[model samples]
Target: MADSTGTQARDTRLYFPHLQTLDETVRFHAERQPQTAAVRCEGRSLSYAQLHQESNRIAHALRAAGLKPGARVAYLGKESEHYYEILFGCAKSETVLVPINWRLTAPEVSHILQDSGSELLFLEESFAPVLEQLGSAAPRTVVRLGATEAEPDSFPAWKATQPDTDPAVRVTPDTPLAQLYTSGTTGLPKGVVLAHRSCFAIRDALAGENLDWIDWREGDVALIGIPGFHVGGLWWATQNFNAGVTVVSMPAFAAGEAVRLIRELGITTACVVPAMLRLLLGEPGVTPEDFTTLRKIVYGGSPISESLLEESLAMFGCEFAQIYGLTETGNTAVCLPPADHVPGGPRMKAAGHPYPGIGAKVIDDKGQELPIGEVGEVCLRTPARMVEYWGLPDKTAETLVDGWIHTGDAGYIDADGYVFISDRIKDAIIVAGENVYPAEIENVLERHPGVAEAVIVGRPDERWGETVHAFVVAAPGDRPSPRDLHRFLAQRIASFKLPAKYEFIDHVPRNPSGKILRRELRDRFWGDSERKVN
Candidate 1:
């Protein structure tokens, strides 16, 4: 183990150097630390050996159910040991796991199921009504996640009948391990198909660098503060597991519960969004003592305000690293190390340097690389980039050029190679770490009878990075109340995507080409902030 000063130990060793796939990480740990706790969630724990055996059974059950290699298996539930069991099972069988955000509305959920062509779905019992609403759109095979072992269609009972022996299905590092859906500019969600290599690529790169921006040590207990559906949460969990460390899963992020868990579980490390850090700090009765065991905290998903960062730094009293990346880039390619996390440091405004093997550059509209200190689209070239955006070849071609993933973020790098994010090139709003695209919400709002035209813009908020704000042009002789519009949109879109504030306007400003001048409307709320994004 490395010492407290981040220096490498003389006896340093790679945990599973020979492992080529994600599932093999489980086997490697189980063989060495069978009795060690792999995961603890909801008052239940799974040892490494138990997790390996149960995942093997889950793999056998998938094959028994006639799911061929590369079949999409959907999981619509919160974080749990069962989720990882199914995730590894899919990896072992060479199947793709599609994790649906349970917060999405039925129609949104139905679209993902249809787009992925998932044959089997494992959902929590609480979300059964969502599946019911889908009816014919739902998969043919649906299994309840939490049920007694004696229950007929419960996940435990279903896997119990299957043999626990390893199926030993051939899988490679390039095999599609997960298909995570991210909202697109086209008013629909696009599936980001990630391969097994994403989980290990950055880790392997950091091994030779000896930098401890984010390191995992034995006895380290990591908190999965974000939902597992997002790439941030999935990647964080895999990193800890790959290091053979115990992970504590939160079914859903509750600030009060997170505070309690940190103290009770003696969590040593955590990866959370900025919004979660705010909530954890504001949780009633929370004190610095609650975070005594925390050695490091990794935060990203949205730009954190300076005030929050300073407050968090003083409170948590741990090393904080800020990560920056998109789902298309396999989560994090750039990390703001703890050394640069000074209160008023010049690099505090920057998003930090890239990993050892990662490449980041700013490009002009013509795809020409820009000189340092010039703001443009930030592009990243990493081994962890997604294989493709599912089946959309044209979209894949547009984003992934050469070996670089063109992140739709406008940012510049300094002479010292520090990345400083300015604003978003893509007109997507991030609310509490959840991606909300204006096109998707505008599509739903325009369908309302009283709404003639609708435009969505992000309004910076202190709590959530940004809140959805809508500008509407009422139909002739028709005026709709915010309450009425909220009700209409609530049923059609996810709650997080709903507009928090609305304005009645005569016309929406647009250019001659009829493209919505979203910046004009968004600028009214931003005023003169240094960074357009919160």
Candidate 2:
């Protein structure tokens, strides 16, 4: 372990090199909790022992499908027990697993599948339609979500009747675990290659730490109520499981259904996004008792309002820990401790000090460290940093400089070393607690026939913290209503990311460099405002 002073421990002979492979973690749990509940989905539970055996069989099937050690296999499905099995199975077999977002469109999903160089795709029944036209998309084998066919074909399921044995391939710590595609503010989405050790280290850091916010007890089941495609949802699930905790999961976030599951399963811990948190909090007849049974609730995405936080603290009768993290760090590098949730808390506005074993510093453009209370860019150096941006060497270099992943958040560190997020350096908006890049919105808006050029910005919102606003230049002859614009955007992009306000602009301010002066449009709304949306 490194010293707390951020120096290498040369004098100590106990050199704990981080575990580099995902199989190592799976093996550790398989032996420790063979019969313990490892995963739960839609009322079905799989014990750790059973999970290991199933993954072994899946690994064998993957090899039978002619997959090489370093082959990429995208798991295209919803939240389910089989999801993790496929992920860990790929890890055990030294294969890269890419779990596609169920929310993405057919074309969007195709781009990720093509970029990852996936040779096989394991999709659920619901997503079967999207894979219908993937002939030239790069996968030789397409595995269905259900039972296996007697004869292997282009699309088959080999997991049902396969035998369990040791995976033939061995992977090192640096082995790539996934190629998750996230939208870049500059242009198209890029694949972020995160290694097994990177994410596992994140979970490992949270280990044994007291979760005062949530009342986590032995044998108490938690809910994996989010999609598996995002880093947070997936890693948090593994985090609880690494410690032998039970987890009940759903396909996606839904209010009434999620409440039912929590109550019915007697779930103790739940990881939620701000939007869903609000939805659940707004559920009628929901009182302190409704969520009180839950020991703790962890929420992030957007900064929670004071009112929401207060209600959660009182209603849950436990701590409400708010986390601040990025996918570039493979899920989390910082978490607001439970103790910091109460009144007169230290670093109340800032996400609590960096998690144990992780170091964060605020630096200026020149990379010089800034003083506490000074706003600067937040940079992170930790075991959980992603390996690189796949197929984008230049972009990767610009992002990860000198072992520090540049988190493009404009924030400050307090005297107590607590980090406070002020604004995102990139023109990205957090709507309903989900990161929605302006570039993505612009791309979709520009596709409209009556739109010439579109620029998207964030507007201060009381309910959502920040809502997307679009300024567009009309084409030949047009007068688009706000409702028409919203409906058009709703058809192209996710409903939550559509522009809430539309402005007709004759010209967009651009500097000599031809870069759109987004700051100008942003200033129009937030100039007289007191604070930037966190």
Candidate 3:
């Protein structure tokens, strides 16, 4: 594909030809390093050989349970070795894995399950209440993740009866492997359908480049600080697994636990958000000595504050690279290499240059490509881009136009190709790496009995990058307390999506045509800030 500059991007497949499909990763690595630990989580570990065998069993069990090729298998749980087993099993069975964010409310989870048309669901016992709340929306075949010996519907018990032989299912690089749901602008979540090839495209492009930026090495033990439900975490884990490195999974991210894991396991590389970095730095008794083994720390999700970046650089004393992209772009297509990470370098604030085979351009509203340093909507063309937004042809066409993923981010590329993000065009708030769309929250807020109209905007936050703030207009003679509104929103949405602050307004500002002036409202909170996003 040619970039906006009319230059053709190199084909990634030609650079590295191995591991064309997700299933091929484990099989190839198992043959080469069968005894090496593929993943470790909560005192449990799985070797390459063991993971391959377990996934095979899961594949056979899925088939025996009447799941057909191309079926959607939903997983509602935290990060774990069993989660990856289900992931690869879905790959081997030609079924798509839909990993639900465990943080989502029952209503939100139900929407994904029903929308994906999943026939089976693998859930953690802790989320039993959520599944029960799903009721009719829940899939018919539900299997518990860690079940006892007496439980016949447990994942371990169910797969144990199946043979641990490869299902030998036919799959192509374009086959849909995972469906991750991202918050939509229309008060719902849209499933982003990613294919097997998405996992290998970026890695293939960088294979023999010998670039130290985000490179993998022998005996490298990586910390999966992010959860598997997010594309960043999933992509990072798969990249390490493909390179035959051991990945230590954190079932849930905790600053104290992460520090312990890094020091105890001699973790060499990690990928995390800036919020996590702050938490680690603030953790009690944390010091520079605890991160001696860390060679590189890759961070993204939101741009890092200069002060925070400098502090993290000093604490870790390791190579730091910033990644920029979305789930639609298969995690990361642009990388700010360590070379440009100077404390106050000119490019320090920039997002970064696109990967070898990836193309990025900023375009005006008229669809014309903007010149260097001209602020506009950023677009990316990469082999790692999602196949489509699942079952939404109209949205797919709108987002994936002419082979370029229209990233709803307002940014520009400098003469040196360093992308600088200035604002978000879609009015989406990212709280601690989690995307929270205003429309989704506003829809819920306005549902409250006292709220006549509501608007949600992001306020720059020191730790979370951004926090949800609500501007609510109450009904006539109805006085709504912040506490009451918080309680109402808490039960309906994820905790992260709840508004951190609420202000009662007489009226919500709107344009002549009735469109809410979101930017006008947001500008009040971001006054004089260099960038609109924190």
lDDT of 1: 0.91
The TM-score ranking, best first, is 1, 3, 2
> Per-residue lDDT for 510-534 in model 3, tens only?
8999988888899998998878988
lDDT of 1 by residue, 1-534 (tens): 545433245634334446668788898889888999999998899999998999999999999899999999999999999999998999988889999999999999999999999999998999988988998889989989876778888888888788878778788889999999999999999999999899988887777686788888767899998888999999999998888889999999999988888899999999999999999989988889999999999999999999999999999999999999999999999999999999999998988899998999999999999999999999999999999988899999999999999999999999989899989999989999999999999999999999999999999999999999999999998898999999999999999999999999999999999988999999999999889999
The TM-scores, one per candidate, come to: 0.97, 0.89, 0.96
Q: Which candidate is the best by lDDT?
A: 1
**Candidate 1 ranges beyond 4 A from true positions:** 1-15
Which predicted model would earn the best TM-score?
1
lDDT of 2 by residue, 1-534 (tens): 355522124432111224346576566567766877888777788988878888888888888778888788998878888888888888888788888877776767778888888888887767776777555773777777764465354233467667876676668768888777777887577888888776567554554352233333456677876677887787777666654567788877788888888887787788887667778778888776766568777777677766667766766675667777777888777778777787645556676678777888999989899998888889887787888998889999988989888888888888777888877787778876677899888888888888889999998776677898889898878767778778877656657677787999998899999989998999888886434774
CA lDDT, every prediction? 0.91, 0.75, 0.89
Model 3: how far residue 313 lies from native, Å: 0.3
C-alpha RMSD in Å of predicted model 3 compared with the true structure: 4.6
Give me the runs in candidate 2 sitting further than 4 Å from their true place: 1-21, 133-135, 146-157, 203-217, 344-346, 479-492, 512-514, 527-530
Selected candidate, larger TM-score, 1 vs 3 = 1
- Model 2 C-alpha RMSD vs. true structure (Å) is 5.1
